[model samples]
Target: MTDTSRRSLLGALGALTVSAAVPPAAATASPARATPSTPAASPSPATAATSGPRSSMTFTGTPYDTAAFARSSLGELTATVLPGTPVRTEIRHGGQRVAVLTKGARTVLLPGPERTFTENKQSFTDVFDRLVPDPALPPAKRLKPGWGTSPSGGTWSVYGGTSGDTDFGVHTKGAATMLLKDTEAGRYATLTDDGISDADVNCVAAFDKVPTGNACSFALLFGYRGGGAHYRARLSFTTKGEVDLRVEKVMNGETTLLAEAGPLATEVRAGDAWRIRVRRKGAKTQVTAWPAAGAEPTRPTAEIEDSEAGLRSGRVGVRGFASPGCTNLPVTLITGRFEVTAANWETPPSVTHRDWVRLLDAPFDGEWTPAVEAIVRGWAGSMAPDVFSYAMMFLPGAPGVRGADPRVAGADVLGEAGYGKPDSQGLRPVGADFHDYLERPWTFPDQTRRPEDGQRGNLDCSGYVRMVYGFHLGVGMMAVKDPAKKALPRKSGAMVDFAPGVRVAQRTGSGGSAPDLGQLQPGDLVLFDVNDVAGDPEDPDAYDVDHVGIYLGLDRAGKRRFLSSRKSADGPTMADVSGASTLDGPGIYADSLHTVHRV
Candidate 1:
């Protein structure tokens, strides 16, 4: 978690008529009104765009597979890199080709497409085959399976493992290539014509499961059986003062640490020995430490602890090595490896169902709207969804002003250096904000005469709810800026699972680092209960339910106004937390619970 600021609604809040923004008689004058034909070049009527051949097909959980598409007219084909081996995703769709490998965010084309994929023609079994590696064979060897049979549609599934092999299981039913790689970070991921790099402390490798830090690790989680996860990592060495500690967790080669802490002690003295262990049980992760002398007191440090209880974990191997320092007693994760029995993955964290009545542990404070739920549910069902996780993963980090032309978010978003894309409904954070403004039908500079319009931006009420509902996943915030953004690309991930989407309750909080609750910051999502004095239900959304909100800090009057959108023409924004009872919505918004998600 790191520093973050809440996004303030940019445009002034006043409705405006669309007609007024259009040119009138004088502005719309024909070229005939122009003096002597000086090559009249008045703007001609813009033609309506013809719809491309898009079938009316739509998906909420899984995408619809177009008629077995082998031609370039359809789309791109991608692939995953094997551990130790540097792999890339190269697609030659319709000749408009592009190559993308693991570089965090921004995609790059290999020097030449033909040359780069010459060895991968065999990897081209089917579109989904791109998720794995294939070689030795050519495009002639193709495997076509029954199209409409799979419950999950055609999006290729991504995983991590071996390289340069054409033995990916394509036709063999139930056959899977065991994706094996060093779990901890600091293992090198570079590709040099030869073998893959090892995660020798100081070396960097991609991680399968980690909220932060570059050290790679894994766990076999028990959760939903849906989609997969995306991961990244970096390795670094830091220098401290007196005791130069060597520590390498995925490092970007930046940030000067007081001292670096390597996997093992920077120096092994005459009688010193190294012993360590790391494990993940659900949302909690434990790391124990010791020496050749045996279990030392005050040694085990809590790495990740979100819930109250501990959990059942796996084996923890020790990474051995150390490059001792001299005068200043240097420290660094000299070079080592973190071993694990398995990799546990969590699914979507934010997109979930909430019932306003049961959320008692946390305070139900956010403005819950059925319209928002409806929209989320709609989108979740439309895409191959577990729920909201995928939506949030695709959401923009910043919103744009109404009059501002939408642009490709284009790495403008923090942490999402390579993967952010843009579209109308849900694209860039700024675009979403601007669209929200339009839902308000907020005023435009040129249009002064007409106001109080019901546009997406100029909201009277309901439109705001609709737009917000659609793009809540698209809202950019402090969470998106954190290094963890790359670790967990699915915005809808749960504390443990992230297949379809995340559980709504876990999607709040801010920064790349944690924060104190008393000092509430902006862009924090507060989930709470809405109830009467008797603990009975109270209609927070007027539809009899619980709710949540994008916390705007403690309001000026000390009262908080949660920013939210619901299906209403005119709704109360600055509602009193004391009065609004969280009766229904996502059940997580209870009376006792008041956890804030900082994103």
Candidate 2:
């Protein structure tokens, strides 16, 4: 993509707050023509004051001053707007120009190109008011409680229990601590603070006597939105030194277990401190525990992603619950640290192979016809620019060869081949290595060779289509009753021959070729015979289907466009038939457009 196009896409990340007073023609009509213009005069000090905020000023003159207007507009929005840097407050795309400004978590866009500038009655305050941060609220800073201090002057709120004499106070000895103990059976006590939405609470806890026969537990509570709804990460200790870590959600007097870990074997002595940590953010929750003196475990004891029951923001705290038999048992919890912060939004350098596979399996949930939907899902799932690898095709060697190991081919021909890594917008450049890999012919090993001997990481045009459609729709391009008894095929011709749901829609070049381009929809398979060595066009047996692509509907210009992994500068790209070249030459449109298949 061009730099202008990329900038346009990036600007879309911020919410678009188009001025309501903008002229209908400017807002909805086609692109306006760019006319030559004279420089605009700078406004005087008195005139600038009456123009409301300088950021909301609109240049309204016949001969528009593009340069001066950009400077004045950018100056009001940001203090760091440099003249020549790429990070300049102003961005231009084709004939249109926009000024981008950011303050704290809010971003604002001001449209320009003085000649076509409309009266923007919208104020800067109005735009900022609509800006919503990702988490909606900022995270609280890490907190340390004062030792031997009461909950009255501190951040915590201590509540006395109604069931029995509950001791809810701080015990300051070696460290400042918050302790909660209940003597009554079937009663609970809590020490809470509403300072955080998403956070991690680390503390050490000990039971004076482990509960026997009845339940006794200490828990970290989050998403406490009152009305009996909250999420809990609990540690249940038994007299036998068994500890069970669990995550639960309590809503409307009902408790749902989200996740659980083992009744871990450990020595439980009186006052033996067990370090516990609970981290909750977004839809994910995790809990971990270990001996206070030992090193913390790398993995969490219990973790869950409960989008349905997960809470976004609420009061976070600690609580203790007791059953009938555990009346007199005292559970002590001492705080070490409470840290609440926003989740990282940056993308990692690379994702795992398993994660890459999950991207390929993303479901297609569009509101189109089933056939179209299948194809749309297939296409959407297969486009992963960050994870780059050469296309490889399955090669079944020899006919009627039972138990023959299938091999793959394509990567060897293109040296230094690997998956392409994309930028922030999931777009990767078509480098020299990718172009070299695509220029080779499809090849496969003979029946005697194993799959390991063939190219390791590669996929071709047909192979890509097959992998997506087969995995999602259960429709295979290369159908076989028993693969062990026969060799695998690699050519697009072979795929079309065995594709179960495919039917020929049109055939070009010879006998009768008339394709209704308007009838085409996204996901339709477009096949081509790149080599026209045979004379007969109508005869399917005469030509081999050397290339194939999936129709992706029309472009903004109403031209029919198809996506294909081609031997071009842009590895996998969307090409319009109106501007697409033929196999052997630079001619617009394909020379031997053999068949269009509805699959």
Best lDDT goes to which candidate? 2
List where candidate 2 sits over 4 angstroms from the true fold.
1-154, 163-166, 173-198, 212-215, 308-310, 341-599
| Candidate 2 residue lDDT tens string, 344-379 | 111101111111111212222222234532322332
| Worst lDDT 10-window in candidate 2 | 120-129
Indicate the residue-level lDDT of 569 in model 1.
Answer: 7
Quote each prediction's TM-score.
0.19, 0.32
lDDT of 2 at 30: 19
Tens-digit lDDT track of model 1 for 279-378 = 3344433333434254433433324432211112111111211122222221122111122122221210111111010011112122223432232223
Say what the RMSD of model 1 is. Answer: 28.1
Instruction: Please give the lDDT score at residue 327 for candidate 1.
Output: 22
State the displacement of the C-alpha of residue 361, model 2, in Å, after optimal TM-score superposition.
65
Each model's lDDT: 0.22, 0.38
